[model samples]
Target chain A: MPEAEAGTLVLDCDELEELAGALALGAALPQEVAAAQAHLDGCPRSHTDVYELATVARLLAEAPEPVEPPARLRARILATAREDTAPQDAPSGIRYPVSGGGGPVPGTARAPAPARSSLPRRPVFFLLAAAAALAALALGLWNLQLRGELDQRQERLAAQQRFIDAFAGGGRSVAFAPAPGQEALHGAVVRRAQGPALAVFTALPRPAGSDVYQLWAIRGSTPQDLGVFVPDARGHHIATLPDLTGVDAVAVTLERERVPAPTTAPILTAPL
Target chain B: MATGDGPAVSDPDAALLARLVTRDEAALAELYDRHGRAAHALALRVTGNAETAQDVVQEAFLALWRRGHTYQPERGAVRGWLLTVVRNRAIDALRGSGGQVARVLPVDTLVLAATDNPEAEAMQAVDGRRVRAALAALPPEQRDVVELAYFGGLAYPEVAERMGIPLGTVKSRMRLALERLRGSLRAWERDA
Candidate 1:
């Protein structure tokens, strides 16, 4: 129907990240695996590459003059390890000097709380996991209710898969809460530990003609421009963040034209 | 090393891992005592904060403790896994991290520390020259992407976004970069 829709989307076969990941995790299609195997069958170096890349990665860690961790940290970590729970699910005591406040709720344009972001504690994990699971479970039930609309079901499944993969590899996601009146809008900032954070929004009301929605990474005082996007006909928007290395929070705003800076208050925000 | 996915219980770290699976605290301490410094230093460099690094390394070990059963020694060395875990944790810690910024990563300033990490000391002693040479030989842009992914923990997609390059380009660069490094790294093995 549209010129832009002429081509089909395909995974880049040569993407090293995807290839290497598929090799290690067995996440690739059969031929992909075969291709890798045929290449590595000569020496079977793929798995070992994980460790070898890890060792090269080790060179980075070993760089930067070793600052022997303070002796007390040893005592503290060892003592915590001795908790006898056989790897307590995210020991609460791990993050010493916890950032007390949960950071201001996103959408408030509040101070970026760097201290606020810490690894998801056990309860946080359980709650987030529960929420995600409930979301996924609910989608299946919803699919059952709506027997038709196969396209919508596929989209829902896609979203659910994105949510699951967000939590994969020990990454975390922050849910986006829209204004109370805007119940239809939904989204999340998936902070991937091993990759770029993703800002996924669904049911985003299409911006009026020529206007677009822009994503912004709100650092302390500056808002770094991510990119502007228009959701597909299905009103689904997923944007790849460059990386959330030092981002405080991420937000979305409506723009008549994507500008170097935000011209209006953000319509949505997810505090990292 | 066998290519098959066989249990490497005979490996020293494998032995420690077995003890860890058995819930042996002594094993944890032993593993920590050996790798803890490197782990801590790795986290510290990544997060650039002492407390956070401690927190990261602690969590990584705990995760390793929990997930140690999943380790396949034929995949790679145990210490490599340990370092990668700590590095990932430290990188995760950087999200929404506070205080004085290293601003951007100083990719050029990477300097090997005085000896302490046994695996590092050994690897650095033998393979350091060749590996460093391999890494240095990579195109500045290619090396930058690899360093960003490996040291910064940004995945390839993130690296593409950071460098404003196409995903294909990033992958090709890394494929080339790692191919060269693999040649150098392939020679230095566990026994080597």
Candidate 2:
């Protein structure tokens, strides 16, 4: 047990219970948060308990495979980021409304600032200054655009890292063998947590036309498409199954573009 | 999966934050791309409105931009920190007005996906399906209290009020639920 400081109150067991619940959910009132922090400053045991509880809360937050955000939200966030990076004096004259309407932001449509009268008043000097200003603006905008793309790539990699992390531990793997004349083909499906399934294949044949290998999760008589993929030169293919819960079997088939449903029999499968 | 035993010297988040302190927008956007979905989902679940959830997510990221200095990685994973901010903001929105705002659920990525922890790796790898199943296994009474307090973001007294139960009962239910959850996840660890 930790002692309370002057003008501070230590949480008892019941209060600690409430603090844990609030901390896990991020719903603690400001005063409650302050109080909890105060107590934690003096208590090591309580801190560990709170940390573990928060981990459980995080697990709940991530139980679902994923839901894609509206396309415009990404644009809106990037637009705001650009505005924030705009030169302090000029305040990049752009804005994207947070309402997500994809409408132009208000108070952003404005004419360029007038030149300060302190500069040389000659026409040639004025033109030169304007050119210099334009060049600087172009450079800044170009940098912003480049940074945006790099940021987008970094995010995609981070997402992939998470996808890999999802099965980095505690997933079960099942092997798939080739059928009949397809003795060269070998595959495996790693079932992760609840629904994400990672499938890997080797020695797959390249399909002609727009045909590609599509993965499926078979439960009872019905089957669902996990995703589609193409094998590499060594004939290796790996695909992620977003939602594979209730899957009694896993299979892969070759299908042409625009085909929503399975078009051919599975060349490989791992029955759960 | 990366283990907590190793030094976090090469932690990507620490590197990202270092860049962010230099006012790098790319680092911020990359951070958002990594954790935005989970943060958005938590806000949506709590605030019960897509718009409010979006606002909460944006606010959380901006706060990170402004307060990156406050973060201490040794305390916990960055995803947990972002989700906590979102949840707190959602609660503020809800409590400030007696209005319902958004309703949505889980999304494409786990926030703590790249952290070095077997539990996190296993949870994400397994999606803590067992933990969810264990939660589902609890008696509905116990489950209700846990959900109301955790997901619902209601204080214990509010949880009791919402369920028409005694405050003491709510406390006991929460205690029991947490003990059961710890036992269940620990059991899963051993089985793994």
Candidate 3:
């Protein structure tokens, strides 16, 4: 976004510095990332310096203590792993009850021939087999949940991409940044005469309980509430406002649910 | 190539990977049990939500399962590799299709350092706490720059504007802070 030339495949010292900065920021566009990779691949000196910076950046990314995934997630991961890796013909690898006739159970492979005749059949085998089946079902459900989430993210990205592209062709774009010492909220707004004005924000801090961050289009003393939005990971929030004609300013406020007007102060405001 | 403290009877990450390559589900489970929490935490921090974090973890581990053969022991520990992949996926999700560049990732800098012993050592030697302590020790202004750039995921100019500082100041602070962190981490590596 700062007008760094991304077409250069071979980077000079200045380019290398720029690349390092981009990498640290995780703001490298696809081409920039490739160019940085090419430069690092070709130039060996001080490459480690760049690598060290990346390592440090990565460490900072994981600075927060790890949180345990839900129990169902673990089960789903394991079940999917087994279901994927296990061959259809092969036994589920989970030992099951050998019937009195010494044949394969309904869903599982049979025990070894020699053991089948000699080993005593127990009721617990059925229970274990049933439990294993249920676990597999749970894992399938969990996998579905994961897929649904992936689809949602994809849909959001597609919608944002469309919104951005349409505005990029002909529109006025305003970039927003946090006020001094404030890092929780930053974003941009794009307005096009032919379409609705779109605001795409990132890292918007969550309001305390039941409260939401509402977007307002300000004209004079009166502020129009555009809509309420919550952020996704990376604090991204996007809203398409129906009108933008003669809007003097845009601001975001932390407001209570269903409030008719601005009950409190604005967290972020930018003049149009 | 060393073992992370995990539940596996055979502790080395490489061994687990070998098992994984053979389609051993237990091996995958062992690796997850050992590193899943950290991976999830990193994803949650980057994505800012539990659901997205869950998706990242699911995708990352599945990638490992399907591509475990890609793990080169000489690169680094499996935990480090896994964390890197998880972080990348989360970034991709955050930035959308624009983020998925099929090129060398920032983390690949470490992998490419096999010929450079000192650089490779910086990556292999430092663990989570060492890096955390180094970060915690940075000056507040310096730390803010690093966190906003890396964790907050802003471009350099944006970071400068957000902090209300000059572009030059943001770049200098980042370079200086990184130098200190690299030095501290290298020292910790040597002491260890």
Candidate 4:
């Protein structure tokens, strides 16, 4: 058993826990480090544990860049905003005050109107006919505008397809095998030549918290990282990899960052 | 560089975001000019399809225009929030299309210019690997917490809710996870 040296306070599990918490919160000051160092200098056993915890704290300070939203999403959201501005005449579920000489409200019954003399029925008829013609014209114009917008959208889509065919390179087919217990992740591979190429998707268990599945390519001695990918609420994911050649196998493992990379190994490996 | 301009301002993204909120067409183009490359790179990285990534960039900006009001500076920085949304959308697309995994050629295999010398592409590839390795080395509990917060982009409370754990546990786990990652990265830097 490791013994504490004389004149130094030996930290137990409780003290180590406190230190870990402080380090994680970035609340561990230089003074704390000095105090820890002084204690560690006297008690070597506590030194390694405290130092390791402190290092993990430091890495958390510089977290990786946050994930970015897609481009078309902004357009879609803007379109939604535009839609919100359009007038909606849905029933408001409230009763309005009736004005003088008006019949009963829409939901209420009313007495019949009395006979009227000297009213110009032809002018009222003409007004109604004119209003109908204006409505028809408005409808025609609206239809034309809608058709034009639809045509423009289709043209843009066609242009995009052409651009993709010219610049995105010819697509290729690849196969991937999931790690041993990840039989659910088995899927087909689509390959692109330029840029960050390679992606995989499958239905699997949703990882706990912010943890996501990371893909790795193992070739003999080297373990190359693809990238981190998260599955949806339904436990489905599509993972992308950095370009690499001569990869013998691919694996998806639950990964999280650690200070002073630990000697401990991976929890899962899906061999592909 | 334009003549007579003072020192270049850092992070014009807020201005771009504000203009986007107002539905300014020119501002949208300028926003693209400023962040398009980075956004494109990220989209390409996540989707592994240049065409899709390009589309994703366009779509994300459009979303910014429509949902700009939802942006609250109190929640986080604009860039971080935008990136988060973009990544989520890209992932949603990949899932929809049933994209493949393990087909990517390594970054070193590409013949693109290294003009940025120590180009972000190369660095991303290396750093991504290092980060992966470091993540793999964490304890299961701590690793899961860190993963949920970073890659999954869940808030601390959300992580707790998803994991069915107490909020305090999630926070502590996150703290531990970050500490471990930092230590590993430091060691990695030293060795490099």
- Candidate 3 lDDT at B20 equals 69
Question: Which is the better candidate, 2 or 4, if ranked by DockQ?
Answer: 2
- lDDT of candidates 1 onward, in order: 0.53, 0.54, 0.58, 0.44
The per-model DockQ list reads 0.13, 0.07, 0.17, 0.04
Output the chain A TM-score of model 2. Answer: 0.36
Q: What is the TM-score of each candidate against the true structure?
A: 0.43, 0.47, 0.52, 0.29
Top candidate on lDDT is: 3
Comparing to the true complex, what docking class would candidate 1 get? incorrect
- Which digits, one per residue and each the tens of the lDDT, describe model 1 over residues B1-192? 131111122347777887765657678777777677767766887687888988887887776666565554543456655665676456547754442211221111111121323443345333234545667777798788776765665655667789999876776676566666655655655436
Model 4 shows how many backbone clashes?
Answer: 59
Residue-wise C-alpha lDDT for candidate 2, range A47-137, written one tens digit per residue: 4555555556555654432445666666677666545532212112111111100111111111112123444333445677888979977
Q: Of the candidates numbered 1 and 3, which has the greater lDDT value?
A: 3
Model 4 stretches with alpha carbons more than 4 Å out: A1-272, B1-11, B97-177, B181-192
Question: Chain B TM per candidate, please?
Answer: 0.66, 0.75, 0.79, 0.50
Give fnat for candidates 1, 2 and onward, in order: 0.15, 0.11, 0.28, 0.05
Task: Give the per-residue lDDT digits (tens) of candidate 4, residues A140-256.
Answer: 889999899879766754553453344336774344543323333433344566565544443445654544455555544234445666667654455555554566556444532
Decide which is better by DockQ, 3 or 4: 3
In angstroms, the error of model 3 at A214 is: 39
Residue runs of model 2 more than 4 Å from their true location after superposition: A1-51, A85-272, B1-11, B97-131
Q: Pick the candidate with the highest TM-score.
A: 3
